[model samples]
Target chain A: MEATVKIFRFNPETDQKPHFETYTMPVESTDRVLDLLEYIKGNFDGTLSFRRSCAHGICGSDAMRINGRNYLACKALVKDVGLKIKVEPVLGLKVIKDLIVDMDPFFEHFRSVMPYFVNDEPPPAKERLQTIEERERFDDTTKCILCACCTTSCPSFWANQEYLGPAAMVNAHRFIFDSRDRAAAERLRILNDQFGVFRCHTIFNCTIACPREIEITQAIGELKNAISTGALE
Target chain B: MMQTRVVPQRGFNLDYIMFIFTRVSGLSIVLLALVGIILAMVMGARTQMDLGTLMRWTFFPNPNHVVNSDIPDVTLGWANAYWSTMQFLLIFFAFTHAANGLRMIVEDYVNRGVGQLLVRGFFFLLWLFMLITAIFVVLSS
Candidate 1:
């Protein structure tokens, strides 16, 4: 099938303003959008820039706005997007180049949530033990690959950049619900900031945009319930 | 990443509950107000009643007058009961929605610390006072 890909192009050093460029190429029905991008870069425009690692969906490095929604480039099939695909860098981030968004802000929020476990007790004689039930509590959120798809799709983040976006909240939910984690109270307190979990309006955009299929909104709701009922403490 | 220090557990923060209540009350106000307005408009059109009469009916619902009027007493009583219930709900939803909205705005824009707490507390107390006053007036009428 023939596909016309419209890509947003800009180089801060050379371009006065950003613009779109169209490239028509033959693509197989099974070809993913990332494959088409690779063909464009290799054959038509070597200057085109995008981020991709592992060429699979796991790395989550190639998340961008495809046809006005955030998706992992490697995961979206060209056939599914129709003949004309409009691509751009994800919203609410600094666009370094075509289809590439600076992820520093997203990662900064993730870090602020204290993504790692903090157990004050001395290390057990062996690894910490958890029952299967306890492990299942937060298993869903562990699938997040640090992709900014959910955060970028969030309207709350666009309105107030200071708000800890849904992605960070998901990560916090992962740790806060863990039975062995001792920092649940501290994590909850940190999230009690004015820009924290309460900012989410249950819009479900993050839940839809998540590539990992994690129930991001449900996790945030759990956090809200915990905070309201004092269950986390 | 810096390790987070465990803070002393403070039981039952009302902020989240207040937030949820504000949202629910706001939605209820919108839906209830819409129904009330539509019902009023339909009744006014059917009865050929002007806005003045409608306003008077809303502010002063007299069950005794309805009972003695030519209209069936049972029907008029039902109507009066409905009107009183609607009025009470409108007062409750309106007060809670506005008060909660003000609290949210203050918390979002104001500085975080004792100042925000004081302002929110003041708003809560004011809301309670206004709600009590409104209920008293509604019951007396």
Candidate 2:
């Protein structure tokens, strides 16, 4: 299959603004989008910069805006690009190069929520005993790989840049709902702010864009309910 | 280096307080509107005043009377009562009701980027102005 990809190009230190450059490639039907990008970088233009570690979606290093929607480049097939592809850096983020964005702020939000299990009590000799039901509490949220496909797609994060964002909220939910985790109250307390869970307008874009298929909006709704429930109690 | 932390709980009491206030104010507006409608119906348009003029008087104190009486009696008649009731309904609901409503709209129209921001911004400003005006009138009265 033949495809024309209009990729965004920019170097912040050199260029005043980002611009698009097109590359036409003859690709195989079963070839992934990342393969076409590699072909372009090697055969056509070496300046085309993007991040890709694993050829599969597990690494999550090659997330980019492919035809007005964010997706993992490694998983996206050339056939998925349609007639023409207009690729750009993820929205609501500072683009560093062709398809790379400065992930500092994105990870900063992850750090801000302290996305980890926090139990006040000391660990027992073995470990906290748990049934299947207890383990299922955070199973859905444990799928996030920090790829930032969900957060950049969120409109609430676009409006309020300081918003804890959906990815972080999902992480917080993972820890908050854990049976072994004893920081539900503290997590609720942290997410009760104006730019926290309440700021989420319940737009399902995050959930839809998630490569992990995590139900982000539902998680945020649960967190909002938790905050109010905690406040009342 | 020592780590600094800020929790949403620290500043969240105010949001909760505001949420409660907004709910109370919203309910009060509805109740007041209902009362004004009942008052208008029961009292009838006895005074030789139009609806708009009457509404102004209910919200704004009547400047016409300058009686040297000891106790100044404030009477809210039909026209004044209904207009003020409508104004209160508009002001109180505009902020709390409309702001939340637009948040819903933003959630609905996700793909339209600049258009959504522009419309939401306009609604937000309108709500802010109406809330301020409503507060001013209520305090003055």
Candidate 3:
């Protein structure tokens, strides 16, 4: 199959504005978008820039807006991307070059939520073992990979760059519900800020855009309830 | 499943009341303001038209022409301010209320996982987006 990949191209330091560069490549239907990109970079154009660690979608390095919606290029099939595929860096992010975006803000928001466990209480000498039932409470939350596909797909982030975004909050949720972790109050206080959990509109776009298929809105709902009811207190 | 307490219920009573009030008040005020503006335009037109034409419409009820001492000049300043304030209030309340409602929806749905993390993060960003947009428009205007 032949595909026209119209990728957004620009170097912020040099180019005043971004322009689209289309490359027509003959590809097989079974080929993934990453495969095509690799082919282009290796054979046609070496200037093209993108990130990809695990081609199986575990490492979400190749996330971009493929033909509008956000997805992992490595996971998306080239034949599936319509005739004219427009690949651009995720929305509400600064495009450093071709398909790369500055992930500093994304990481900042992640860190702002205090993603690590904060247990002040004395630890049990033995393993702070939790019952299977207790472990199940936060079971769903531990699936996060810090991939920004969901955040970039969100329209809210498109409008406001300051939001803590969902990924950080979800990470916080993982620890918030853990029986061994006793920082629910602190985490809740942090998530209670203006740009925290309250900003989510539950549009479900993030959930849909998520490659891991994690139920994001539900976790956020739990967090919101926890914050509003002063559960953390 | 672990025996975790259910989320604290924020009943629909307050939400329903606010929704109804905003919808009713906003619609009424906007409509009334439009009517007032139109009436003022018509009155202005009548005053500017030829005396004969003005009299034709003004005298439809065989109105008493004793340029009354009891009549007060109608100034729309207070009305305009009142109406505009009402409109702004309704919009402000409605927008925030709706935003909160959607936030609640998010809390009710997204489960913890990569999907949850990415989605909630995305939602937070979106909230920030709307908030900033609202602020910018409010401030610049």
Candidate 4:
């Protein structure tokens, strides 16, 4: 199948403004968008830059706008994108180069949630134990791979960059609902700010954009309910 | 790189407060509008009134129209009270919901920072103007 891939290209050092460049390539129906990008770089233009690790979509890199939807390029098959693929860097982030965005803002939000287990209780002899039910509590949110897809796709985050984006909230949900985590109170307090969980308006764009198929809106609703019902410490 | 730090405000978080208010006000508007429509329909049917007559009766209730009938007077009084209260609430919710919705739309197109703040401020001013005008109109009537 012959596919026309239109990608946004910009280099801050050389170009004053970003522009789109189209490349035509022979692609197999099974070929991922990432494969098309690679073909463009290797044969058409080496300057075309995009991030990709673990071409199977596990790395969460190579997330871009494919046909107006946020998706990991490695996971979006060429056949699904059809004859014309309009690829651009994810929205609401500074583009560093062609299809490459500065991920610091994304990571900053992720870090704000302290995406890690925290329990000050004296360690059990070996490791913390959790029942299957307890583990299932946050099983959905545990699938997040730090991809900016959900956050970038969110209109709330686009409005207020400070708004703790959906990815951050999902990570917070992971720890907030964990039965063994001791930092639920602190995390809840942190997320209770003006730019915190309250900023979400249930748009569900994040839910739809999620590559992991995580029910982000439902998790956010649970957070709101937890806060209102005083479920947090 | 966008800095991600919490700005600690001393009082209740406005976002949280507004988030709750928007939902509550939305529901209130829907309920009040439904009730208002039904009451209008009932009053219209009672008097065998047309749309223009119903509008006048609703907006400009003539006290003298409630002649000797105790039931008519009581029903008119109740309807007037309900209408006045709903008018006030509808204005408040309509303006608030519109302003908040506009804020979301602006945020999507405008970049975050001073631009967003300025746009939001302009929207706030517009909402305030509309609310005041609506209140004045409602109360005067």
Candidate 2 per-residue lDDT, tens place, A8-75, comes to 99988889988888889887767787888898899989988999997688878888889989899888
Off by over 4 Å in 2: A231-233, B1-11, B14-87, B96-141
**Candidate 3 ranges with C-alpha deviation above 4 Å:** A231-233, B1-141
Best by TM-score: 4
Candidate 1: residue A133 Cα off by (Å): 0.7
Against the native complex, each candidate's DockQ, computed on alpha carbons, is: 0.16, 0.09, 0.06, 0.21
Worst 10 residues of 2 chain A by lDDT: A224-233
Query: Interface root mean square deviation for model 4, in Å?
Result: 12.5
Instruction: For residues B1-141, write the lDDT of model 1, one tens digit per residue.
Output: 222223355344455556777778778766766665566556542354346544444433323212223344333332555766766677787788788778767765677789989998999999999878866766665
Fnat of the models, one by one? Answer: 0.12, 0.08, 0.06, 0.23
Q: CA lDDT of B124 in candidate 4? A: 94
lDDT of 4 by residue, A55-152 (tens): 88799998999999999998999778898999999999989998999999889988998889887889999888877777788899999998889999
Could you tally the backbone clashes for each prediction? Answer: 0, 3, 25, 0
Q: Pairing residues by index, what is the TM-score of model 1? A: 0.75
Estimate how well candidate 3 is docked, as a DockQ score: 0.06
TM-score per candidate: 0.75, 0.71, 0.65, 0.84
Model 2 lDDT, residue A214, Cα: 90
Q: How close is candidate 3 to the true structure, as a TM-score?
A: 0.65
How does residue A184 of candidate 2 score in lDDT? 69
